[model samples]
Target: MSSTISRSLAGRKARRRRSRVHSLAIDGNDCMRQDNIVVEIPTSTARAATMTSSSDPIPSLGQHVDFRQRFEEEINTFATSLVHREPKYVPSHQEDALAMARIDSSCETAIDHWMLAQSFGCVKATDLTEGAIELCQLLVGVDGCEETRKVLETLSAHESVSPKNFLRGLCAGAITRWVYLDTKPQLPSVCQYPQSDVLRSVLAATPNIYRRLVDAMTLEYLERHFATTIPALSKELTKRLHTILTNFRGLKSANTLTDLSDHINNFRVWERYMADAFEGALRLRLNHLRSPMKYNYTFPSSGQPFVEDKMISLYSEASRRRPHQVWLCLSPLIESWNESMDSSSHVIISPARVISS
Candidate 1:
């Protein structure tokens, strides 16, 4: 009975020793016993082990996907808000038409001033008369009439018509006759697409893109519509001058002969000027295409009634008469075209400058 009690006491002592060792391992002490080996761990390492065991697990694949989706949703919402913002303002058709009219008027006025200042000023009536007399001497030689000389002398002395006015009138008349009567230009058929509300909205939203589009369109239109007819017109004018020179004596006055010489001289300067002017006008016209508007010019025919709104009388007498027919159109009327919800619309920007009978 004593031996049995002693064995029971030993078993209890061994069990208690194992319990104490398990408790010490869980506490992560600086020194521990495992299988009778002493293991030493730093306080920091023990603390890190404890923390690593107790902390939350690493994020899962599903959680990562959810986070990405939320971020993308935020980005999409920002983009949608930007799209709904107020669009940039676009000019109305009427405003564009008026602006273009102003530009055209200003350009023409500048050109006229330049022509007067540069080419016309250099050629005096006396110089023209002398050139005509020389031409007559060359053409008629010994057969030249004394009457022709007297007519030229009289014309040079006549101060009633200023040289500037005379030259300008002559140039205007010749250009009008050539363009409208001799060789009228046939405008090429341009395939124009009307702008939809959506497209306009897009353009209005992005100003840089809109500008680039306009520039490209203008350039393309110019490339296709450049005035090839101008060279032909110039050639025709030269031929006409030659014909006029051949029939010099048939002229009503020696003023005609002097004017012819002035016209020839002016043509040399006008060649480059006309090309530049046409290009500029075409560019201006194309720039307003965003408004879906069309620009055109109307050349008045002879014997057409001279309405005040549609025609400007070059002669003081025609203005005084008030009710006169156009004898000649010095310049064409510029018109703008637009389409309404119901019908088409036409507005004249500038009137034709005319000589009336």
Candidate 2:
């Protein structure tokens, strides 16, 4: 009888569990279907004991609360921890320190201060140095002061000084002397030989100044000046030519003439003489090399030949005096001159015949 009673109680408990599961499923289904409706889920411990945990089709919306504030607080705490953390150590570079010290110490003088400002502001140190050198050269070339001369002398004396530095000094010295001491209105005097001793000193000190001078030379003004000062130039030209010719006679070698002609041709000062009209002096020098006999015979037969005899050619003797290679290059030019002369003579002779008739 006791066994039967226990069995009845067990059957009752099983029925109750089934009933609770059924009720919970019904509530979950209703909550899922009506999203706007807030289902009151009973928070009783007896009800929780009867319900089994499951992946619900829909969770309770009424019980749901935002975790954004909690997440933001956690993030704030993490950021604050990072902010309060010890800073990393970066060691200073020695080169940077040295460069800053050098810049601070080296910048002196008005020009140096200006250069430093430019270097710090917009320009590089190398660029500033180059620009300063260029400006200094220009200033010296136009008109150098005593201070500039001393600066140049100091720079030139330094074994480590650059070509630009020495050039700046040289240009200043040359220009200063030309403007102040050798103010001859004659172009040849100014261009050819201006205060030779002083000019020589500058050039000797800086052998690289030749190219800069040539590039900067004004050819048009030089040509204009040449036209006005031919008389003064003629005397100088004659003196130099005589010296060259005497040297050529002593050498008795055509190579001497070729070397001299090359020197004269390459000379920037005598560039104006390369024109067809003024090529007489150079041609005459070449002619002497090609036919020394012409000069030798003329000196004894007639008086010392004048510059007017520059074109006087002895075709037979021309080939005899120089080697074939030396005269070969000049053959075409000689032939062209010969043809022109023949045509000119024919025109003259025809006009004379008409008058006679």
lDDT string, candidate 2, 1-357, tens digits: 999999999999978866665566456433322233334344453344333343222445543545555544544443334222222332123332332233222211212222212221221113223324333333223233444444444433444333322222222222222222233333333246443454354455544443223222323234344334544544454333323212112112344666666545434232222121123322232232222121111110011121222222222223344312111010001111132345443211000000000
Off by over 4 Å in 2: 1-54, 57-63, 85-127, 130-357
> What TM-scores do the predictions have?
0.35, 0.14
What is the Cα-based lDDT of residue 284 in candidate 2?
30
What lDDT does model 2 reach?
A: 0.30
Off by over 4 Å in 1: 1-268, 284-291, 316-318, 341-345
Best by TM-score: 1
TM-score for model 1?
A: 0.35
**lDDT, residue 351, model 2:** 7
Error of 1 at 261 (Å): 14
lDDT of 1: 0.46
lDDT of 1 by residue, 296-345 (tens): 55666444687888777875444456656654454567666664522357
